[model samples]
Every structure is written in structure tokens, then in C-alpha cells.
Target: MKDLIKDVHENGVKSDYKEPKLYDVVPKEEIAEFEEVMREIIADIVSEASDVACWVYVQKYVKHKPLDDMLQEWSEASQFILAMDTWFERLMAD
Candidate 1:
């Protein structure tokens, strides 16, 4: 949990890391829409999963927001997913 919070705090949305080139193919508006929607979805999942087992939370998370193939190559998006995994793992362990 500490790592999750620390990672998120250190790597907030506006970071020094370069935005993935995947955004180049889409219109800026489209990319912005996707990013906003995905972030909202992620926040919702994390909030709701606060009391569930890892597996159950994962099931709900995936069901609500299945991984989009287009985002597969976006490291920025992937980083958030990875961070959420860590958060969920630690949260569920308790």
C-alpha cells in the first residue's frame, strides 16, 4: 500500500516521462477522451475494490473495464494499470 501510494504520488499524471507515441495516431481530442475515461474507470475500480479479495476485485475490474487492445502499447497507461495491480495486491492481502 505504501509502495502504491508512493508510486502514484511520485509519478502523477503530469510527469517527466514522455507521453507514449501511441497518442500520435489518434486525434488529440480522442486521446484526451480516452485518458479521462480510463482514469475515471480506474479510480472507480480502486475505490470499489477496497474491501474485496484480489480475485473478486480483479473480476469486477476487468468486467467493468476490459483491457483495450489499443492501449496495449501505451506505456503511460500501462504504468497506471501496473500500479493499480500493486495497490490491489497489497489491499487484498489485508
Candidate 2:
């Protein structure tokens, strides 16, 4: 995705429309602070999701879950984490 953006900027695609100059909504000086706050928010969400996953795992164990069920639970938790991380990466990229 980054590569595509870079290519569009550098190589001039055949489109007749001109791209508007995108301005920073946040002031340049405050960008670092803004990003730090965003990171904190993302971190909190990720932490909560992790805690929930752990809780679910404990519950399953207490119930004596079968191996297939346990594996499914793990896969779900992993996918959720991966999705959150990917979303964060894209957000930061923009």
C-alpha cells in the first residue's frame, strides 16, 4: 500500500485529475504528542482484548475443553490481535 502511494506520487499516473495538497489537521509541533496519545489508546484496547482472551482460556480449561475447542479459541485470539496490529499500522501510516 505504501509502495502504491509512493508510485502514484512519483510516477504521475495517467489521470487527468490533480490531487489536492493534503494539509496536516494537527499542527506539526503537536504531531508527536498526538501520536503518543493514539498509541496509548491503541495499547489500552489491545491490553483489554488480551485480558479477555486470557479469561476465556481460563474458563475453557476450568470446563475441561477438548483440544479442538482450545485450538479454536487460540486461533481466534491470535486473529484478533493480528487485526488490531494491522489496523494500527495502517492508521499510523496514514
Candidate 3:
């Protein structure tokens, strides 16, 4: 029983880390939208167009808007993109 609860919690956390709150409403759709937006987010990051893009997305989508914490915010978006790439690779492999 304990192991079952742990497994359930672990699975819950993984979904949260990837697509966030919207994942619950429609996990597949939310993940798809995230992958699409992440592409543009990364292009902006690479070109150094505006670090602000990361904040804009968070402020709009995420509920609690953190005040301009670039390091954490960038890391979150960076990791999110990395996660997407890993999933995509696995998805393609199958």
C-alpha cells in the first residue's frame, strides 16, 4: 500500500514538472502546446533577442508571477525545452 502511494506521488510529480498545471486539464494538448512554444522560446534565447520572453510566458500561463528572477526562470524554461527534446527523441525512436 505504501509503495502504491509512493508510485502515485512520483507519477504526479513527473507530470507537474513537464507540462505544469495545465497538464491536468488536458495533458496531451498541453504538452503539445508547450513543445510548440518552447521552440520559439529557445530561438529567442539562442538569438539573444530578449530574455524577457521567458518571463512573458510564465506571467501569462503560470499563476503566481515571480518578479524577474532571470536565473531561475531561464533555468526552468531551459530544462523544459531539454525535457521536450528528450521526449521527442524517444517518441521518434518508437
Candidate 4:
């Protein structure tokens, strides 16, 4: 209570106002460029994983499931991996 009263007397009665800050400090264009590069890298990873998955599926097929099934599984796995990476990034950000 004493600290609040002191703050009101020194600064102002309205204590809710906040000063803005440049938290990240990086430029918007640079951030966008970095994101584009990361997306390209992720796409390459998904493509390579899908290629390997195709070969592995062909080698393991018994009843001979369609190629679409293998592709779908690979796509889902890639997305899951990407999602996990996103979750980790969010955790680190906090």
C-alpha cells in the first residue's frame, strides 16, 4: 500500500500505463527471410523422409498395400515431427 501510494504521487495516479519495448530487436524482413529458409529446410526433410519411407514400405509389403497408404503414413509422420519441433520451440520461448 505504501509503495502504491508512493508510485501514484511520483509518477501518476493511473499506474496501468506501460512503456513499449523492442523485445526481440530483430528486423521484420530478416525474421521473414529466416522463416523462409527454415520452411525450405523442413520441406527438404519431409521429402527425404517420404522417399526413404517409400523404399522401406516396398521392401516390407506382404499383401501389397497401395502406394498412397505409405505416402500418407510418411506425410503424417513428418507432420508429427514438425509439430513436436514447434512445441519444443514454444516451450523454449517461455
Candidate 5:
């Protein structure tokens, strides 16, 4: 490429800017923080839905699911809601 030639001809230097250090990443705690944020988001959505709303979801996903499945889904949904509320409270307080 002409750009490469220009750099060599003009500056007489060689360095690859495209190659980067692999250490420029956050630690595991940062990933945990993101996962917590996602859990909180799911919780808020579950709260807004209010009640075993997974039947519709199952129906949408696979078209017909049992009562037990729906109930379990609702339970998980409630857990997410609680977690989301907690996250929001903490975030807003901060």
C-alpha cells in the first residue's frame, strides 16, 4: 500500500499499529458486574410482566407447554424481578 511506502520513505520507521497488547481487558470482577447487570435487567422485565408470563413465551418459542413448565418459568421470572429491583435500587442510590 502507498501509505506503507509513505511512512517508510518519509519517516524511516517501522511499527505495526494493528498489533495490540493482549492485557488490555478488565478482570473477572468486571465480567461479574456485567452479568449482575443483565440479571437485574431480566428482573425488572419480569416484575413489569407480573405473573407467570412464560406460557406465552413457551407458546411463542415452541407452541404449547405444560402448567408445571409455566409455573417454573414464572418462579424464575419473579427471581429475576427481585434481582433487577435490587440492582436498580443500588444503582439509583449510588
Candidate 6:
């Protein structure tokens, strides 16, 4: 997972990545529409992740929650964010 993140960061996201064969069969307009919808979905996932992370941080530091419980929540949130990021990167890539 770390390697995938590093590769994405180093190579950068390829929003335009698409197969030539797909272009031959599918209309460009349809492809554009699909991509737009996908971008919107990814944006929603990122927004939700941001909200979860913020909530977890508040629970841990502001509310003075127990260390073990807070740490577990934090870890889960962090993993979720990372997974979303990786999925987005892969979606944008070939």
C-alpha cells in the first residue's frame, strides 16, 4: 500500500488515461459522461473521509477520550482515508 501511494505521488494521477481500444468502440461523449460521474463519486468519498477524520480527531483530543479507544478509531479512520486515496489514484491511472 505504501509503495502504491509512493508510485501515485511520484507518477502523478493520469486523469486522461484510457485505452485506445475503448475509444474505438465507445463514443467520446459517453466516456466523458462516465468520467464525470466517477469524479463526482470520488469527490464524495473524499469529503466523507475528511468528515470522519475530523470527528475522530475531536473525539480523541477535544473530548479527552481514552487512549486505546481513540487510537483505534484514529487508526481506522486513517486506513479508510488511505484506501480511498489509493482507489482514486488507481481509478485515474491505467
Q: Which candidate has the highest lDDT of all?
A: 6
Pairs that collide, model 3:
none
Q: What's the C-alpha lDDT at position 1 in model 3?
A: 64
RMSD of 5: 17.7
The whole-model C-alpha lDDT of candidate 5 against the native structure comes to: 0.58
Over 1-94, each residue of candidate 2 has an lDDT whose tens digit, in order, gives 6776787789975546666532346777787888899899999988888775555545444675654564566665656544544554466579
lDDT of 6 by residue, 1-94 (tens): 6876687789985445566685687787799887788899999988888886566556645786654565575675666645544554466576
What are the per-residue Cα lDDT tens digits for candidate 1 across 1-94? 6776687798873446666685676777698788888899999877755533343345436655443532353445555555555676687689
Of the candidates numbered 2 and 3, which has the greater lDDT value?
2
* Candidate-wise lDDT, in order: 0.59, 0.63, 0.56, 0.62, 0.58, 0.66
Give the TM-score comparing model 3 with the true structure, all chains together: 0.25
- Stretches of candidate 4 off by over 4 Å are 1-27, 62-94
By TM-score, the best candidate is 6
Output the worst ten-in-a-row residue range by lDDT, candidate 3.
49-58
Error of 5 at 13 (Å): 46
Comparison by TM-score, 5 against 6, better one = 6
**Segments of candidate 3 deviating more than 4 angstroms:** 1-26, 49-94
Ranking by lDDT: 6, 2, 4, 1, 5, 3
Residue pairs that clash (backbone atoms under 3 angstroms), model 6: none
